[model samples]
Target: MKFAIISVTEQGHKLAKNLLEYLENDPSVIKVDVYHKNVNSTLNKCFEEYDCWVGIMASGIMVRSVCPLIKTKFTDPAVLVIGENGKHVISLLSGHMGGANHFAVKLAGMIGAVPVITTATDLAGKMGLDTLAYQYWLELDHRISIKNINQNIAAGGKVDLYLPTKFDFLKNHPIVNTSYKIDIWNKTFIQASFSGDEIVLTPRRMVAGVGSKKGVTEEQVFFALRSALQHLHLPLSRLDAIATADIKEDEEGIKLAAIKSDLPLMIKSLEEIRNFQHPDCTTSQLVKREFGVGGVSEPAALIEAGDNSRLILKKTAYNGVTVAVAVAI
Candidate 1:
């Protein structure tokens, strides 16, 4: 995710730089662009390019800058305002869907500031499904349903809740008076039915490790990727990210495929991928000769999923492309 850190003074600039250094290495924090002076115009000019905004100035300035750009909480970026002296960080807009509420608490901790949150759901100590969906990287079957749920909760309306399985954390989550019966994880999504403003959240749990020959066509790569996931009883929507060896960074087939589908592509170094081992994954002498690695797909997937990855599917060949699957720990 990207953040636009807007500051007005030298002190604010210092705070912005400090935050950038602190969060620079986090994988989820892709970019933290710092802007000083004329923050309102700059933010007004480039608001869409960022995921969130951190204003290190007066709350009035923040309000004036973001008020004109406000659309809906669902589509707007999460915004937080930190006092110029850095004593308070307030969730200015897009509290839940934009993640400003959660990020406010975190950023406040970094700077010894108090987080000011006015969202009704948060003050009531309830967790809406939309927040969970965003946190888990799950896509809601209907965005409107989640928004409705949050709206009702904010209005002090009582609503019954349901969950398929017990998540230890959700047990104490913001949802009040919810019951559990079945396992949502194992239930077939196609046959499942929910009523009365219930939200359907689809978890993106799969990551595909791909290996392609030089000059592979995007058509062949897409066909092979979809076919592999279908065999595993999962759909393309459930695919989280794409993984491949860094050596294939210039490979247009997978690059274009990821762009076309709008998936996060993780390309690890050849040595990093080769350092890991999969019991069932095959190592080609030919591949080792050209790329200094025995296999690309499986190991790349494993590395992308980190050390605690559980391999679900081994290398499966399709034409000139190979595919693998792993779940992160």
Candidate 2:
């Protein structure tokens, strides 16, 4: 994952540099972009390009600068703020559920800073609702679901435990309320009151369709991908994988989108699409000739039939550039 660290002080710069080095050596962190002192000026440029942001400055400034971006809700990248002296590192937003809290704790340990983890369930060493949702690949409609679940759990209310199979954690946890006869597929958990020990179980699957123009940079591609997902009312994390034509092999945007999304880009060749025998399909000769590959045909062939899908967004021009989405069914 890519990261951007902003620090103003000389000491902060040194610390940021050291952190960059540490992240560079770690396999999980693919890149670290350090921006010291002039964070406000560079914020816009760096915001959409990275997976996480670490600000070594006053908490107030961190909050202010990040607030606008947060309001936009483009993507939930882990945002953290560390003290200038490395005394503390706090996850301001997108904590464990977004994988930010976990990243903060790891960074704190490496730098010998105090990880001021404030998430109640995490501090209590109990299962966090958001974390649980992440583990099960479930997407909550709102952040209030997490708050409500945590509040109920803290108050000692029993929560329903719904899983495909019984696990040792569920067996041992005191708050787990389980029923062997319950079938999760047919039951909806929307109106179920939280007893603090119960959790609804459900399967998850999503696809992210990415479109790119020739010479499209990674940053541009990311913006398009984010806009497309937002238009479709889908979260980036929910995307299971990306589908595109084989010709995008050299497209930087396509490559980076796959990496940042942590989803494999399944590229289909022309022959593969030609062999697909779907009667409702429409072939695009212009697209084939232009891209030297069939963009729509490949994505359609790769997706399962009868699955409801929509075209979330058409190509939106940005500074004379265009991008589009091709969601599948």
Candidate 3:
């Protein structure tokens, strides 16, 4: 995981620097960038660049900068604030719902600091749907549904699992309606709904692709993907991965578009593309010439494995730009 460490004071700067060194040596942390000036502004930039933030400053400024992001629904990153003196580490934002509490405890253990966990639901040792959503990167489309599910679980009902792997952590979880069998590959939303209290365990549906003509604007790509998903009756939250050719790897417009969508853009190499095979494929020559790659691996994967096979959304925007949406088959 990548983390941005922001600090504005001398003590904060030293602490941030130490934390950076510690995190750099930790395998769990892929990258850690330390900024010792302009805490709020730097934090905003970090929020744009990184998945999470670690603030080695007072709670007041941390709260001030984070409140607006959460209030505006502006893709807030997981936030953890630590005192300069190393007295306390608090998961102030996101908490259990956003994985902040879990991160805080891990970081605190690494730094020998006290983790100040304050989420009531977690303290009570009950199942937290929001936390589960964060773990799987699922967008909680219906908070009422979660509330109702949790209520049922709390009332001694069982919750079912549709995931491929068994989650032993959830075996004795206090808030599961019941445990039922669900095959991740073959189950439909309607079928899963009828299989007793159920939550689908497939990958998220926020992933999208943008095959653009030369010099296409980011807004155009975004609009095309959104329109395509809407046309297919698919929510953006179900996406799990975005795919494109290696040529678009450094395209700022394409990269930012994926980030804005909360989707990881996987740039496939030519060899990887050549490995794909599909009988009904239609874009062979176009994929090779435009993408500078051999096959449409992403579209093929989406088609063969997508949940809503009957509702594939494919569209070409301005010029030769194209976008495709499919659930895991």
Candidate 4:
């Protein structure tokens, strides 16, 4: 994830640079940029650009600067406040979904500072619903009463849990109320029949594996994808990713379609797909002759989704493209 460190004083600037060097060395941190001059202007202009913002200044200064910029917890970037002396790192805003609390603890460990996380769930030694959703990559409707649900969990209150059989792992989670029976949503979707008071987590586990001919347009790829999802009565929003073989990584059409559709383009190595064995996958002689693989779409989908994932929709040929869907276990 991208991070921006804002510093005001010369000491703060030095601290920010030190923090940036440490963050850059971490494998999980993708990019770290430090800004020392024009603090207010930089924060205003680049607030949305970075995934998280670390301010090496007074807590009041950082809070006032971000007050107007703060929107909702779901959309805003994680904000961390640190003193120039680097005595403490505080998760100031977007503590759950934006992962401010997680980053604060990590940064504190790197810099020998105290990590101050103020979220109730953290203090209660329980996982917040929003944090659980973010960690698991589960989709939550913005309209849901997430604040109340999180409050209930934080106060040692019970919240009913509903999940599919594949997500039974959540039953052992700290936030789950084991006393209540875990209601199962037998269908692919769990959002269709749930009350507002109950906490719901929608797992985005569908991967749409695609194979396309050379020089196909983005429209053609999108058409094939839409057709395949329609056959299964699933919406584009339900899809987690679009998978393809690494050999087709240079296919601009598939890449463009994934970008336009706001889906991740998951590319699997040809060797991985060749070795991936699935009984239900369709074997194509033409694919084997060309890419030395029995199939492209079906195997790619199952391989990228998970080991236990099964094909929800088999290979379906469309105009210049083949599509398959898999639900991750």
Candidate 5:
């Protein structure tokens, strides 16, 4: 996360310096840059370059600087305006969905300033859907749905945060008892509803291992992976990465599929694949002859699924492309 500090006056500069000291000490390791806007400097440039903006100038200046650039809740960076004397920390724009409100509260506590969060959900003690999504590292399927939900909640509408799986942390959370209701589906293949401001969040908890013929096309590889995920009732949103054996690391088709999927490709060595244990994996005589292993996909998936990993789906092959899935326990 990057925080850019904008100060116009001498007092604002001093306050920026003081806040910088506290921000630099933050254990979160966020990148922070202070910009004392000069005659040639552009506030518009800061909007695109930084994840959050801290303004010590007037709120009017901050609003005018950010007004034309505001696109959506997901795209805009968090904006905060602190008084020159450090007495007040106000969340200026993109408060809930963009995390400005959370940052405001944190900066307020650190600098002994009162935080002013005008978002209705925050004031009503109802957890914002976007805030919950941010906390869990879940990507928003659509920001408009979140905005609609917040608008309804502001008008005394009740929203439900449904967890398809029974997460222990959520069952005991204090927010469950608040205005937002928590429901655990505890089932696979839970369809998310975009209507009624209902948002769906997936943990992105699975890794897929792939192995393909040397000359296979990237299209074929993608199709095979898509078929395999469908069989498992999983979406690409639940995948963390695509794992492959080291020998296939430089394979063009595999590389292209990983690039197209926008997922990290993790390669495991022969020794690692050999050491992994997956009972239900397919026995490939050709793979055994090449790498002296029963299978590549299952073992690689097991290794990349991380510690205490277990295979959730055995190898499935189609059109010379093979895929297996594993889940972190």
Candidate 6:
């Protein structure tokens, strides 16, 4: 995770430096930028850029400084406050979704400091719905009443938890089993819509397989992918990965499109795509002649999405690009 450390005082700078030293050696930490001066300007500049912000200052000062920039927890970065003496590390904001509370505890353990977590679920010895969503890489509908559901869980009240069969293992979690009344429903996360005022965590299980002619622009590929998803009435965020045949590994346009979409580019071998038996896979004589495969997009998507997967959208060609979408069973 990327981190930004803001320190207003010399003593706080020292603490920030110490924290940086600890974080730099950790393999999990991707990047860390330290700001020992111009606290206000630095906070404004780095707040949205980094995954988390560590303020080495007083709690009141940190809170007041971030108050103006604070937005919804879904998009905000995790915020933490650590005293100059490094005696305590407090999870100040975005405790659940942004992972401030979990990181605070981990940071405190690293530096031999006390971690102060004030979130209700953590205090009640129960995992919050937001935390579960963050930890398991599940997407929550921001429109839902998450606060009320978490409050219910903390109050020893049971909340309905819906899960696909693939995620049945989560039922074994001690807190989840106790706090939620789970129903195993085998369907897409979006298809299994909420039955009542309960928590619904959508698993990111869709893969978009792409096929494009050489020298095609990233815009063409991206537009094709977006168009295919739009046809299904799904958002771009619902896609988990962009898949293509291994022969097109050097195709910069497809690669750039995947990068621009912020999704992983999964390459499936030609043999895998050819051997796969899917009735919906389009028969392309040109593709068979060029790459020895009947199709690229449909089978590649189905292969990357794994076993028991089904094509949600069949191959749709746009300009020189072809796009298909598949969902894991």
lDDT by residue for model 2 (191-271), tens: 223533344433345454444567877777667666655643445654556765565567777788679767777775645
* Least well predicted 10-residue stretch by lDDT in candidate 2: 177-186
The total number of steric clashes, by the backbone 3 Å criterion, in model 5 comes to 0
Candidate 1 error regions (>4 Å): 145-148, 151-185, 188-195, 205-329
Who wins the TM-score comparison?
A: 6
TM-score of every model versus the real structure:
0.59, 0.54, 0.53, 0.61, 0.59, 0.62
lDDT of candidates 1 onward, in order: 0.73, 0.60, 0.59, 0.80, 0.74, 0.80
Question: Poorest 10 consecutive residues of model 4 by lDDT?
Answer: 187-196
**1-329, model 4: which lDDT tens digit per residue?**
57899999999999998998998765345468999868778989989988799999998989889998988899899999999999999999999999899889889998999999999877888776777666555667643687776676677765566666555555655445422335666754333222345444578588989998898889999998988877554457667789999988999999999998889999999999988887668689999999999888888889888878867677888888999888764
lDDT of 6: 0.80
Question: Candidates 3 and 6: which is better by TM-score?
Answer: 6
Expressed as tens digits, the lDDT of each residue in 179-258 for candidate 5 is: 45556676532223434444556563578999888888899988988888775444564577899999889888888988
Comparing candidate 3 with candidate 4, which one achieves the higher lDDT?
A: 4
Model 1: ten consecutive residues of lowest lDDT: 184-193
| Residue pairs in candidate 5 whose N, alpha carbon or C atoms collide under 3 angstroms | none
Root-mean-square deviation of candidate 1? 12.5
lDDT sort, best first: 6, 4, 5, 1, 2, 3
CA RMSD for every model? 12.5, 12.5, 13.9, 13.3, 14.4, 13.5
Ranking by TM-score: 6, 4, 5, 1, 2, 3
Write model 1 residue lDDT over 1-329, tens digit each, in one string. 56889889999899889888865644235457788899767987999877789989988888887888889877799999997788888999888778898889878888788999997777877666566555544456667666566666566654453343322234443353332222334442311123465556555456889998888988888888888776554555456689998788898999998887678889888777667775545688989998778899888877776666656566777899998877664
The alpha-carbon deviation from the true structure for residue 251 of candidate 4, after best TM-score superposition, in angstroms, is: 20
TM-score of 1: 0.59
Residue 275 CA displacement from its true place in model 5, Å: 25
